[model samples]
Target chain A: MSTNGFGNISIMTRSMAWLIVCFLVLPITIVFAVSVTDKHYLSLPEQGISFQYYEKLFTSGPWMTSILQSFVIACASTVAAVLLGTLCAIGCWRLGNRASDFVRMLMLVPIMVPTIVYALGIYQFWIDLRLLDSYTGLIIAHIVTGLPYVVITVSTALAGFDPRLEQASLSLGASIGQTLRLVIIPNIKPGVISGAIFAFIHSWDELVLALFIAGRAVFTLPRRMWDGINESLDPTMAAVAAVLIAITVSLLCTDAYTRSRRA
Target chain B: MAGLEISNVTKKYANFRAVDDVSISIKRGEFLTLLGPSGSGKTTLLMMIAGFVQADRGDLTLNGQTITHLPPEARNLGMVFQGYALFPHLSVFDNVAFPLKVRKQSREEIATKVRAALDLVQLTALADRLPRQLSGGQQQRVALARALVFQPHLLLLDEPLSALDKKLRAELQDELKRLHRKVGLGFIYVTHDQEEALSMSDRIAVMRSGKIVEHGTPTDLYERPNTAFVADFIGKSNFVSGSVVEHRDGGFVFSGGGVRFVQRTKGPAPAIGAGVSIALRPEKIGVLRSGETAENELAGTLTEWNYLGSEFRLVVDAGPFGSFSVSVPTWQSDLAPEIGAAMKLGWSAAAGMVVAQD
Candidate 1:
């Protein structure tokens, strides 16, 4: 085939890819541009650059505390979800029975059911258990919501894994636990890490669950951002949003890097 | 050097018997192949020997010690799976060192053994490369080195060369045979390829439907299959169903479909009226000139001809006896047999053997 004969389809596909890329990136680019503006009341960049909004955000007390609380909650919840969800997915894969399939569907229910329903029900359950407004309660709620990400990613990784590796390891003087640690975990490390990262982001950015479950004592970043936006339109709020967007971009970039590495 | 003995081992998954009362013994340092087609229970039998699958009815012993209840790790057996199964994340050195590490060998001992194993497979230069970076043949050698590094009591190869191309498969077969001789460990190989079994094994257990129908040396199984299934499966054969005409010295004469055949067989050769089956291998039947004579001669016409590089396969239509194939060496043949040409086919009485049809 001649290069000229590659035809209009090749050019069309190239332009279409760029169009999709722009579609996904335009909002974030706009938010970045607005963040650096001197007047940041949700307007375009028509003024000089300034760092006063970022300074304002740093001086804010509740926002800083909420950021720390979000980090703590996300970290704790991701650890719990990845641990429990990976084990559950492994069990389901090995068993391949009706009961385990039902359990797998149950694990996926959080992803399917509306968050509002889960929040309302979980709020009532926590109140009955006297766990409402507690950090433990919030962590447990995030874990429940974040576990499906761990399950899906781990299951995707396990699809390429040969069950015979487990057999081969066991046959070669390794115990079941040793096989899980040495063979299974090493092979699925990328998937498990990606799942944990996604779960952490899910918990960190979650607003409705935090709103329904947490109180004044256990406010998170998203909850505080929701309150800040509702109360007043300030440049500090835009600065905080921009920082959250940066964290999300960093996490997504990390996920993409890990995915490419796995490939 | 542990010899394995399996006694009346039966594996029942629900109602279907995957390995039914199958018993075989592997002597120390012997290379035995479980040869069969797909779903013939060869792999299941190997898995049972490796302790991956438990036998429901019988016991297994290695070096006279009961290992039926032992886990695979405790059995101290090495295995090479169908698709190499080398860890993609690990380098070749680490993969071969894995078994030794699992055995809790010292770091220095592991290095020495891994190098020795890699050198044995001629893969020392590729030790630092990951498995995915190597070709199919190299990956297979890595798997072999990994399986052997720990010096296990027995080695199980489950169709180890099945994943490679034909040329590479043949190359690896020679390497595997050499490795077997060097290691001098008991090897239980499983493969569906009959030629692989014939070329590499000390003895072969021919399996069909979870049963060991025949077990013998490669020559014995090829030359003296006891059943029609075994005779047909091991090589190409022309089966002539007949009724016994007479019992003679160490043999019998049978007549089938208006054609007579003499068979060398054991026992009373069935009663005079009993039905029988005679199996004749294609290469055993010689193509002859017009005036040739033998203990059995048939008049036929060449119905089909195929040139197989070194040999000519001719399907001859013998009247009332159906089509019989004769394989003649191409080098020895003066002229190619033309299609529809009348030809004479002959075979000695010993070439055809009576086998049980079932």
Candidate 2:
């Protein structure tokens, strides 16, 4: 095939890129294929394709409850994370000093620290606070883990934003709050939206933090999926994995679309 | 008193003084330009006037009311930033209506005022276009409309036309002057372009080393500069440095580089033997005919020359006395310039002014 305008990308390099995509996406494709398996256990369709597992996903009490719980936790945590993270990013961007640099670095500590280690720390803290096994503890843990994603995306967006727009807004009689609402926020809207999406996905797909803090009362979808894998070998598990993959892929696609639109 | 007053403003960053004890009172409806080279604190002083940069020591008052401590939003001044700073997300109409909206104006009022402001800049047709969609000159006009829509007490423009092409810049310069007159608002324009300042401003404040070196009408500063820095910065000038040799008549004679020239001054002449520097404009010196006489004359060989459309710029290498640059108008000069040709350059006593060395 011709390299076209891609600047002499060799056939081997193009094949390697395809190879990497397959390597990354093949497992999800397998899960998707298994989701339509005819058999009750985990296996590719043999007799015929079936939608029974998918039907079970929507109809089953435990799966539906877990999905609802996960949705609520993800949404609550994403809202909290976006609020705090966007404020922190704007503050650091405007301050533009060594101290703000240190603060921004500190906000990234949750992402830098190993997730299992942080989960264990949160586990201990939640037990002392008597919040373990509750919605509040799980949401708090998810928010903490989701914050770095929000901060990183928002900060990247703020980096491209011209500071003079803020000055122009103020000089034109915009109050500080008015400037943020009318000028700064609108200009950095893509970043904020990207951050919110990432934060939501971060909380939604999170397993380790949910495993540590969540109990029967606050069972999230990821924790339930983990339990399903350990406790049972069923096509329903494949169906759930396929659904999560689809949701994540679509969210990421939306992010890419919005970002490209901005460019 | 119905204008902006900036007094004793100083801005220090670390050890560098960005603006040093600058004071200027702008009369109502005056076009005052802060003209300087880069890093000359002209922009800093303008920022202080716009309430962006806080003065370490100063009093900024608008019409007898102190506004030194006021925030930028409270200052009620419109600023057209260096690069226009138009909101990318807003349409040209919305951008012009921003200040009015910020002040919580009614929808009809904002529409009427925005339409009028856009009409003022001849951008009513582009009201729906985003800033990124418009041409450079169009964006500049939008910025002007936005700054004026709210009828700000004063308008501050920081190198507003620096981003445009030469032809467009000239067109906008005339537009800005017309807008100033029509609106009758105080305009504090900052620029490093001397021609832009000269053609547009009623008064020009020449700044250097964080201080206003001199401030006067453009003609006054160009014709009678107070310092060597102002003379060289405002326009092209040849410097003749020497000590006062004799006080003859009302003017005095100064000798430098084996050449003596008479300089006319209304002020007291520097004491005899006192070091004095004279700034002689290139256009003031002319090529003298064989029998023609001038108050000061020098004979030199034409070392180099350039034909500049309407004028011939010749570099004459006068021996002992340094080279003198003389501009001869194409219409007035009958002599053809040639390299290595000896020529007599002459200028009257009133042509040179004694300026203090910066």
Best by DockQ: 2
Runs in model 1 deviating more than 4 A are A1-30, A33-47, B266-268, B331-336
Residue-pair clashes per candidate, as listed?
0, 0
Q: Interface root mean square deviation for model 2, in Å?
A: 0.5
User: Chain B in candidate 1 has what TM-score?
Assistant: 0.95
Total clashes, candidate 2? 0
Model 2 over residues A14-101: C-alpha lDDT tens digits?
Answer: 9999999999988879998999999979999999899999999999999999999999999999999999999999999999999999
How many residue pairs clash in model 1? Answer: 0
Q: What DockQ results do all the predictions give, each relative to the true complex?
A: 0.76, 0.95
CAPRI category for model 2:
high
TM-score attained by model 2: 0.98
For candidate 1, list the clashing residue pairs, or say none.
none
Recovered fraction of real interface contacts per model: 0.83, 0.98
